[model samples]
Structures are given as structure tokens and as C-alpha cells.
Target: MPAHAPARPLEIAAAGPLRGTVRVPGDKSISHRSLMFGALAIGRTTVDGLLEGEDVLATAAAMRAMGARIDRGDDGRWTIDGVGVGGLMQPEQALDMGNSGTSTRLLMGLLASHRLTATFVGDASLSKRPMGRVIEPLSAMGAEFTASPGGRLPLTMRGLVPAVPIEYTLPVASAQVKSAILLAGLNTPGITTVIEPVPTRDHSERMLAGFGAELTVEPSPAGRVIRIRGEAELKPQSIVVPGDPSSAAFWLVAASIVPGSDVTVLNVGMNPTRSGIVTALRLMGADIEALAEREVGGEPVADLRVRHAPLSGIEVPPDLAPSMIDEYPVLFVAAAFASGRTIARGAEELRVKESDRIAAMAAALSAIGARVEEVEDGMIIDGTGGDPLAGGATITTHLDHRIAMSLSVAAQHCRAPVTLDDAAPVATSYPGFFSTLDALAGVALK
Candidate 1:
């Protein structure tokens, strides 16, 4: 691993009402799946516009270590020549996934089916997130794990030979766990089924299908049931991952509430499972229009046109949490700039993300003199309604990418610069965030 210098603290002055267009990076969820699916396929898979962030790079490294021939070209494209299903080798070094839970959890599934042994490690943030949810299902498939007592990382996995297939119903709404089980099923001997009560992101299903895996999804009265046939070969694919809606949320909120600011974000993902932010924002009276709607490489995408408008708070249901789980911190930020109050419930998952997002966002917003109430599952934010935020405070980022980005956006309307501890982690999801925002509006950092 390479060590880089820590980020310096900086300030952002309040911006004048503005207008511009910005395009964010490819979707993080889809980007991770691209690599994982490509590695599991039998032939060569080509990927364009993949996010080169550190976290996704960690996934690429882990796949290469698992015997995939993955390489990068000068054209900013990536190619992976896979070792075929069930052909993954036992990695010599412990897989270090850095700050990516998606990468670490999904890799565990692929490892569960083969007859191999491997260890997983990560940075401090990744070390803290519980992996037990994923471990339990994989364990039921006959794999064994030696992990920390509470199932934290620095864990070793012993893959199951003649792995048994399972009809697992998810206890929680997690795309990671569901995808893990489905990936494990790729090499098992029978049908592996997953029942998701609330559908999470569907990238794994769509990409798996595109790669020629035998998968069928049926919506039952019980839930959305997915069945994958085991020991099936996956063909190579040409993938063009869509832009991340989570990354687009910041701009969507900013443009929606900045009062006279208008912007267009091109080629953004409109996956139904991940479009809750757009839906919730529109429910709050956001002025947004979707244009050029089309399907690209098995994912739905469109151009989003947004303009500044008055926003009012609305009650967000717990059932919608799984769709926009990664966008809550910034949604809270948007709520702070809206009219009335925004109440979010059933978001306990926020507690275990890159940081305790609820606590981190609440503390940071309150420090800048915003009135916020943090609840067990979610937060209550009183909007400022275009009023200048009481700034002159530095926010603690806790090394979380969304926290760093959210606070940076809040600084745009604050009285003084809201210096963040380290913004370097933003690269994990939105590598060009600051620069793109800088070009669109006035944001200065020192």
C-alpha cells in the first residue's frame, strides 16, 4: 500500500446564486459489480468510464490477485480477462479492500464457492463495519470463517468444496448481502435463491444477466425473489457503467435550493432502486426534469436538468431507505436549506456506514449553528430557507467520503469556511467533486 499526505483544512465562502452544467463519475455500485462480474466471466470483458477511485481500484487489485488478467490502458479504459467461473486461485496476499464494504463483502461471496482460503483486511473505517450479516449466509453455504468476535475484518475465509445452495431470505435490506449470495451461487451445484423484501440496487442482477449468467427475478407477494443456477458459465461483456446517482445528489440538492442556480447532469443512473433521492426531492417540490432517457448496457440512465426552486420538507418513509442509503447525509444538508422540517426514519443503517453518518452530520451541522435533532434511526433538520448558515466552524469528517463532501457543500452558504479534516477520501466515490463544483460555482479552499 502507498501512503499519501493527509489533506489540509480549507474554507468555502458563500456563493452567489449561480448556473452551470456538471457530470459526475460512474456509479460506484455498478463500477464494483463491473469488476467482480468481469472477473467471474470466462472471456475478456471491456469497461469504459470506470471510476479509478482508490476503493474501486482495491476491488480491481483483489480480482487480479484472484487470477483475473486485468489491465489499464492509456485511454482510461480497463480490460479484464477472467479465469472463468470457479477457476479463481487462492490469493497469496491478504486482500486489502481499503474503504470499500461493497468490494470486501462481494468478494467474500465469490470466495465462498471455490476450494480456496484467503484473508481480508482494510483501513480503519472498513475495519469497524460489521461483516456478520454477510458471514452468516455464506457460512450456511458450507464456507468457514475465522474472524473477530463480532465479525469485524482482518478475517480469514475457508471456501466450501461442493458448496451447498441456499434459499436465503434477507433479514435486512442489503444489496451487498444479496449480491454476495448470488455470486456464491455461480459455482454451487443447485439453485441459489435470495428473497429481498425490499429491492435494493439491481446492478448485480442486470450485470450478471448481461454477462450471460442464468438468473431469473420474480416479484412475489413475499418479496422480490431472485434465482440463480449454479455451476453456470458467464460470458464476457462490454460494460458502460452509468454515472452515480449518489454523487449526483449533492448537485441535485445544491441546484434545487441555491436560488436561481440551474444545472444539467448528463448520463446519470436512474435505477429504480437508487432513484429515491430524485423521488424524495421531487416530492419536496424540486424543479427537475429528466431528458434523453435510455438504457445503456443493461442499466437505465438519463440526463437530469435541475434549476433552483423553493423546497418544502416532507416525511421520508423507512421503506425508501434502502434505495438512497448513501445519499442521506447530503439529503440532510439539502433539508437544512429547505423550508419547513424534514423527518427521516428507518435509517439506522446510516450508523454503520463509512462513519456514523447521523452522528457525524448532526454534530457538524449543529457546530455551524444549524438546529438539528438526531434520532435513533434518522435526523430532523429545520431548513434555513436561503438564509446564510452560521459558519466559522471546522467540521470533523471522520475520514468518511460523504461526510467530507456534505460539509463542503454546506460551506457554500456558510458565513465562514467549514474546514474538513481530510477530503482525500472523496476520491473513493466522487473523485472530481471539488473541481467540478469549482468550475460550476465559486468554491475556494485554503
Candidate 2:
């Protein structure tokens, strides 16, 4: 709710048993895509359960600047009137994307093939993150850009009309890069094909097809082949976003580490591409059960009932990295209280997040008395066998939301309160996190 990502310092201590059913914010990934697809579709598209987080709000603002009409009704549904493909107008001013990498990248893709030019800027954190991954490929498609050094933001982009289409293979496993190319393909002349060497989240592919875009997927020796026909028209859809599993992971890890805890997270997205946290936790000997498994809004859904159990660390499978990329901070926290050493490998992607998560967690966890060391790609953490950590240090959040919340969850087994310097970044993905943590801890945050 703050005008910017402020520093809201808070001290987190072990609360009485975490016991409750909580629905965290709607999926931030899905929320951003819903608004984007809605703004690309003709007529009216209504979205229910959209995350009102500042990240998603930044997306809404960008769409509005491009001449789309977006508003939320009293029923908590967001309605969008799109400008359709190739219909975007040049914005009057630079788009301030706040702390969302997802919004900035995806919107860049959407703007790449249109006949418009827009400048973009973000807060300190986002400005430091690399935009080269999105820029290099979009530049290949003839989109010209003037960026800060290393393709960082505070940049201006000139979209190419009737853009050239090319087949690009992903060098890394990133849903954002793939979606950007596919979104730019919307107005391209020929087919825009993306070859993904590693499968990441498939929300864009599934949602694009649902919205009447011509998209397809096939297995290839290299990896997977995805093709999108250009000049596509998107049909408006009524979308319901599922609860963010990334947010659910905090409670999952909290209940797993804190003794006498029982928590159930409801309506969480169980999409295979994004459920690596559940898998990695299970590998670490977590006592989690999937209850009431069902399908919702084209994605798998389940209620995860997590109870406190003694966990033993394992060598996290490298294949699980892409599925749970957003969850490593808390996964690191989960490892801190496990029985043995937990090694997370093949997760070089952590280096480029809102913060260098691996280094950040290594430094923070070590300072809080956990035996932690950073590797080039991942991290190694020696656990405390469920013992409370001797904590009395201020951990900096670095304008990263997950860093702020992961430490909060880590405080479950701390002897003293763990102070976070910037709890405000949590507003980007999970605004109700503290309140929900309060309710489970038997306190009223209000």
C-alpha cells in the first residue's frame, strides 16, 4: 500500500503453533498475464481473484498508459477493454514498472512488434536487474532499444511494425523470455517459434490458446518447440487466478520447521512447472499431503495440508530448479532446520533475481548461526535438527519480497526475534502475508 517499495522493519519470532487455512494472494504470475492478455483481447475481459499487489498494479498501469481501459468492479473483478494487436499507442511518458521483473519483461515483449515507442523505468532493484535477456531476442526481431549499460532499465524502446519473425532457442529456463517472444509474435508477419531447452512455466502457452491465439507445442530433440502464428486476434476471457504456490510455500516451510504446527493452504496452483517446492520439500522429508486434488481454471489445484515433521536435507535435484525458482529463498530456510546438509544445485538463476538470493541467504543464514556456504550455482546449508536458531541480527531485504518473507518464516525456530529491514517488498507478491501469519500465530495484525 505504500507509494513505493518502502522499508517496513519488523521483528519475527516463533509464534505459538501455526494452525489455520490460508489463501495467500492470487498468483502474481497469473495476475500479470491475465491483465496483459485482457488488454490484448477485444471487447471486455473480466478477471476474478486478481492479485492487487503493486507488481500487478504496475502492469495495469502500463496497459492503461497504452490506451486500454481497466477498472475493478465492486464484485472484486477487474475488467479490461483491450486495444488489440498492433493497436497500442505510444505512451505519453515513461512507464514506471516498480519492482516487477515479470511486468517489465512481458510488457516489453508486447510492445516489441507494435508501432509504438515507450520508455520504461523502475525502482532501484529493478533498475539493477538485467533486461538483456528480453532485449537481445527482441532486438533480433528488429525492435530497437536504447538501454542503460548491460541492458538495464531507464531505457527507451522503439517497436518495429510488421516485425521480422525468427526461431529463438532459450539459453536458460525462463518463462518470462519465452512469453515475451510469443507476445511479440502476436503482431509479427510469419510464425514466431521459440525453442525451449528446458521447460519452464507454460501459463502463456495455455492461456494464449485459450484466448484464441494460434499456438502449438511439440517435443523436439533439443527440448520443446513452440510456435505462434502472427497477427493473431485474442478473444476476451473470464479468468479466475489461483492462489500463488510461491506464497503458499512460506506457510508450508513454516509449518514444516516449527514444531506442533499444522497448516492447510487452500486453492493453490499445482501446475507441474511451478510445483517444485512441494517436490523439493517432500524430498527433504516434509510431512505434506495433497488433499482434494482437482482442476481449476485450466490449471491443477489442491489443498496442501502440512504438518510439522523432522526433515533431513537432501541434494535437491537439478531438474527441479525451474519449477521452483521463486521458492529457493524459503527452501533455503527450510533447509536451515533440517537434520543434515541440504545442497541446492543447478540453480544459477538465483543470481539474477530481485537480489542475488544465493549470496544473500548465505550471508544472512550464516549470521543467524546456520552453517551456510554459497556455491557458484546454488548453496549448501547444514541444518540444526529442528533446534531454534540464536537470532538477533537485522537482515536486509534488498527490495526483494521473497527475501523479506523467507526470513520471517525462518524466525519460526529462532530463540530471539529476527528483524527484517524491509518487509514492505512483500507487498509486491503477497500483501496479506503478515496478517495471515498473524492469524496463524494467534495474533491480530490489525
Candidate 3:
């Protein structure tokens, strides 16, 4: 949908016990990387369980624009015939990234050393996001960028053949930034190093190596040091993306708080860096158990079984911020129903996401009669001791999918129905969110 598409107002009321088993969509991070890496690999690559969300589709469209042959078969598997590393063709028009900051930033890195000039554009929300994090490192590697003011999107970037490689230390803990630097390094002639003060997701490193790139990771005094050698050849392989833990977060918190709710989410990705929500919820006394641990497409996988339980809020560790950064909104919703106050700090990164998640969640919670105090980095929430909240206000989602979905979960425990000004944003990452909620709750969310 276009950024200016009509607002999809949705209302949710308290439902009965939610009991069912379901599979969420594939991991958005992995889905994005699969298409990108597949596009740069030398042979045919097939992907199963690829997320068909708008954000992932944007990445697919961008890859197609750059001369990759991508098609979806009737069986739902996607096939990509790649042009190989350093073989990208210049896109004829500006790449419209929709709401996917991941696609925009990572593609910038991929294009950094390609000897081509491409333009990128996105929706209102994505255009507001700062792209300087990526532009800075790619620029340092000899790529030139003409971004909008404050280095936002709707920008043109010119890549350099024989790009200079440099060692860059991260100023913030961001997988997108780290991945951007590494993607740029793929087409450069020498080793490009990225020094991290804190570790984020390793999807890029893992997928890069899986696609036959020369990459190495080791411990350093600074943090984890990652080096990638450029001008490398890539070999395509079949990939099966696991269920997104981020998408499973809603049901995890929902089942924990709602009475008599017992739900199982299947095939959730359990990558250590991405499973902080489960750990944090368990810390708050959530009755969540991991069943059938296994490996899918080289990432840890498991089925999460969650049952209703009385939760007690605890001071969230600052170190866990990087791991569960995207899950904070739903975590805050979970905190609102716990037995005590939940304190979350060191998550200043939330301020720069699709929305200012801290502020957005704080306001939405307060409007629904939950006690919440907004802070510089995070929020402090006083729970209702598993009691239903007074939900009587219409929430402004600001076109953020997580916020919309989190509030929907909150509405399941509300005495009054909660209305969202725009539920369309949910399609960006989890298109079936409301329908799945319907299946579990056994009622139309309407």
C-alpha cells in the first residue's frame, strides 16, 4: 500500500481464552538477506518460507530492479537467478523501499562498491528515518551519497569500483548498520573490518559465509571484530527461513497475561541474539517453555509453548537491550499487566525506529489507563496485577506495525474496546496478525 493510503481503523475487545497452535511468518531479517544474498550469488537459489510482507517484498522488488531474476512458484517457494558478486546492473529508476529501512540501508552497502549510481525513495515514515548511519561508513569506503537533509532517504548514491576498504567502529549497536558495512565490503577489493562495542544480530555474517564469502569473526578488546574480504564469488544454496521470533512476541505476551490462554507458536527462530523477548518474559514469571529444539537454515529453531501465568515485573537488564530492541513495545504491553513496576533502560535505540516506540507506547498505554512514565531511553510501567485495563481511547499508531500489534494484544485484556487509527501498517511485517489473533481468540477482531 502507498504511504498515503487510507487509514485502516481497527477495534479490538476483550476475548475469551486463546488456545491454538499456529506458525507466524518467516523471519523478516532472514527473508531480506536471503533475497539479497541470492541476488548476488552465482547460481540459482531457492528459498522456502520467505516472508511475503510488504517490507520483504520491497527488498525483492529492489533486487529485481537491479537485474536479478526473482519469481515465486505456485508452491510458495521463491527462486532467484543471480548475476553474481559485482555483477549488479544499474537500476533504471529510483528504488522505492516502502517502509523497509533494512532494505534501504543494506542495499546502499551492497551498491557502495558496484560502480553504479542508484536512487532510493520510501514512504513518509521511512523517509523520516536517519540513513546517516549507513551513509557514513559507505562514504568512508569511497561511495558518494547525495541524501536528503539529515541524511534521510530519497537519495542518490554513486558507487566506486575499486572502493577503498576501511576499519570502522560502531557508534551504536545496530544490525542494519553493521550489515550495511559488511555488504559494502563484499564488492570492495580488500578486507573490510567492522569493530563492534556491542554485538547485534549475526545474520549477515552467517549468510555471507553460507554464500561462500571469506568472513571471519573473533574476540577483541573493543568487542567482536568482523572482517570480510571483498570481490568474492558467491554460490547459491537452498534456504528455509524460520518463523520470526519478533512476530511470535505478541502471542507470547498475550498468552502470559490473558486468563486461561494456552498457545503454542511453531518453528520460532531461537537465534541467541534475537530471543531476548522470551528470556525477558521468563524473567517476569511468564510460563513459556521451548519444545522441539532444532536447526533450520543454520539458525536455532523451536516451538514456544506459553500458558497464562501471573507475571511480576523486574528491572530489565541494559545488556539485553540490543537483543530484544524490536520487541520492546510488546514487552511494555506485557509489563503493564505484571504484578509490579517494570523498568527498561538502555533502549534509546527505540527512539529511531519506525516510530519513537518509547513515546508511542507510553502515550498509548496511558490513554488506556495504564500507569506509564516515559523516560529518555525507555519507560517505567506499573502493572495491574493481571487485571484488565480500562481501554477507551483510539490509539495513533504513527504507521508503526509493532505498536499497532502490541496495542491489539493489550486490547485482549481491556474492559473496553481499543481502536487503532491505522492498522494497515501491520501488513508491513505481519500481514496475517489480525487473522491469527482471530483464530486464537475464536472471534473476529474487527
Candidate 4:
């Protein structure tokens, strides 16, 4: 069994409006993709602004085991010399992906079509997460998996000889699942297709093309059909990862929900494919100004200047859930302080993420004295609507990164301090979160 050394839990207190210019870390999605694509490409892929979080580091370790050479430069950039398509060597040891579902699932796809066997292990949190979704789809493509009972991790994957391509339609909207199948197709001999009914993040498709993979997307009545021609050589190129929109989401909600607050988050990745939270916040009457919009590394980027606003709640469209699936915890925090009611639908995906986000958010909101109702798929939050939150409680984070960040930010608008238990899990994504927020609040962690 593997153990992670835990950091001391910190208490965050509510303070006045935050004013500062802080550049957030690189995008986690892009960081993971860069390592995956770089490992599968033919030449050295240099990445600038890659997120150095634990989740992404796990992905880098997996790539190194598969025969890719990943090195970090003195200037904080990473360079990867890949093993190329069909060139990966069998790893000598079990791949420990820690608590990263993205790393585990996507690697399953890559392993599914290769001519080797690999075993994956993770922390208790990742070990408990279901791998059945990736297992079932990759199995259909001729991969064999033996997991713990209930399809959990510490699993072994034996790739099939003469692997077959698959036409898979995702039962749920998951980018990890989508990316897994797409990667499996890269080593197969024919066209592999995946149909996503609700649009999830398209970073995989975009990065695949950038790596010189033969991929195409066509709109269909059922959903968007993505087809990739198998057995194509991937050519490596330089990539600059964008700032994480999910991380920016916390700052966005904090600035709008806290009184007398005004802050601008710069160079945020605003890929329309991942902008559901912005749309939802705008619908709830957030005062957000998009400035100097431009393109970077084939994705949209902009400076978001957000100010305190009187927010009112509205029903978030269920179909839009895929774009901002990870932002719901913070969205719930914003909703807790809004004027009316905020209802979320089509969020069954939240049940399987880092923790049961839906349940966690409901409990925390209720604990902080906000009236919250948890539905099977989503939640109904009746806001104090800018009323100072009663917030003298410790929230259990359940090893979920977004949960801890959301509660930490939720304390900003409360009448009392908010403490989250087990915030050490936040290193999976936003590593500098508490220090950054503390700098903004002009206070020390006490």
C-alpha cells in the first residue's frame, strides 16, 4: 500500500475585497495532454508554462516508464523526447498515477492498443475510483483488464494482438473516457470513432491534431462524431500550456460574490469548449468584463476583470454541464450567496469525480447555514443572496481539490471563518492556492 504525507489543515477567514494581479498556474488539462501527446510523438516536444502540480507530475512519470524521455529545463519548462507511435517499451514496474483520474484513464487508452502489459496503482482515493468505464470501452477494442472487485484500480491491462478499432458512444460526458478511446485508436489498424452526445472538453482532439495525428470531427444528429485514423506517426512540436480556466473559476466567483471586490485574472484560457461556468455566471448576472481577447497556442485567451455584483440565481442548463463540470463546487458557493435560487441539472457526472461533489457541496452549504437541496443528478440552492454567510464550520474535503478550494473561497463572503479538513488534496491541481489566496486577502494562515 502507498501512503501520501499529509499537510496540516489551514483555516481561512473572510476579509475585504481582494485587489491584486496574480498569474495562475498553467492549465491542468493542457499540461496532462502535453505530456501524453509528447510521449507519443516522434521528436522532442518542448512545453512552456506546463502546470507542475502532482496530477500532471504523475502523468509525466507514466510517460517516462513507457520509454519517453522527459526532462525539466532550468527556466521552468519541460522537454519530452517521445517513443513515437507503436514504439513504447513495456514498463518494468507498476504505474502509480496517484489520485489523478485523468492520468489513469488516458493511460489506459494508450495501453489498450500497445503490444505490452502494464499495471496501474494509485493513492487510496484513486484506488477507490471506478475504472470500469475505461475498462469496458477499451475491452470492446480488444484490451483485457483485471481490476479489483467493483472495477476499481491496482489493475492490470494486457493489450490485444491485432487490436481492433471501436465505434464507441459515451454513456456519460467524460473527457477522460473520450480521450482514452481516441488514444487507443492511435495504435489500431483502422478508423476508430467516438460519439459524444454532450460536448465535453475537446483538448484531446485539438492536441492530437497538433501532434500530427489523423483525426476528424463531424456533427451528427446523435452527437459529435470524432474519427481517428489509426497507426499514424505523431510528430512532436513545441506547446505553451494556457492558464487553467478551472483555477480562474475560483477567482471569478470570489470577486463577484464578495462585497467591494474587484480583481482581474489575466491570460485565462477561454476555450468555448470549456467556458460553461462563465456563461452560467453571466446568466446569474455577474459583472465580468472580457478584455483584450486573443489566441494562444491554438486556444482562446483573455483578461477577465471581475467586480462585485448583486447576483441572482437561475436554472443552469443541463446540456451545458460538460463544459464546466469541474466548476460546480465553486458555482455552488457563488449560488449560496446569490439573490434567488440556482438549480443544476445533468450533473450526474459529479458523482464520479474526485469525490461525490454533489453531496459534498450540499453538505458544506448546509453546514454553513445556506439552504441547499441535493437532487439525484444535481442540486437546488436557495441563496442568502449576498447576506453574509454564517460560516463557523469545518468542511470535510474528502480528498477533492475543487471542494477544498471552493470552501476556502466560500469563507470570503461569510460572517465567520471557514475551515476545510484535508486540504492537502488540493495539490492534485492548484498547488499554490492557499498561499495565493492568503496574499490576496492580506493575512497569514492562522
lDDT of each: 0.88, 0.91, 0.94, 0.90
The TM-score values for the models, in the order shown, are 0.97, 0.98, 0.99, 0.98
lDDT of 1 at 95: 94
Which candidate leads the pack in lDDT? Answer: 3
Order the numbered candidates by TM-score, best leading: 3, 4, 2, 1
For residues 1-446, write the lDDT of model 2, one tens digit per residue: 11454467887777668998998779989999999998989989999999999999999999999999999999999999998988888899889999989999999999999989999899888888999999999999999999999999888999998899999999989999999999999999889999999999999998999899999999999999999999999999999899999999999999999899999999999999999999999998999999999987798989999999999999999999999999999999999999999999999999999999989888889878899889999999999998989887889878899998898888878887888887888888888888899889863221
Tell me the lDDT of model 1 at 348.
94
| True-structure RMSD, every candidate | 1.4, 1.7, 1.0, 1.0
Tens digits of lDDT, candidate 1, 1-446: 33344775656666665477777898889889889888888889999989888889999999999899999899978999999899999899899888999999999999999999999998888888999999999999999999976898889999997899999999989999999999999999989999999889988898888888899999999899999999989999888888999989988987876767889999999999999999989988899899999999878899999988888888887778999999999888888888889998899999999899999999999998788999999999998876768888878888899998888777777777777878888888888888887887876756
User: How far off is residue 46 in model 2, in Å?
Assistant: 0.9
Give the higher-lDDT candidate: 2 or 4.
2
- Name the candidate, 3 or 4, with the larger TM-score value: 3
Best by TM-score: 3
Error of 3 at 42 (Å): 0.7
lDDT of candidate 1 vs native?
0.88
- Model 4 misplaced regions, further than 4 Å: none
lDDT of 3 at 35: 99
**What is the per-residue lDDT of model 4 for residues 8-118, given as tens digits with 9 covering 90 to 100?**
587888878877777788999999999988988888999999999999999999999889999999999899999888888999999989989999999999989998999
lDDT tens digits, residue span 1-446, model 3: 13556898998887778899989999999999999999999889999999999999999999999999999999999999999999999999999999999999999999999989999999999989999989898999999999899999889999999899999999999999999999989989889999989999989999999999999999999999999999999999899999999999999999999999999999999999999999999999999999999998789999999999999989999999988999999999999999989999999999999999999999999999999999999999999999999998899999999999999999989999999999999999999999999999965466
TM-score between candidate 1 and the true structure: 0.97
Candidate 2 lDDT for residue 74? 94
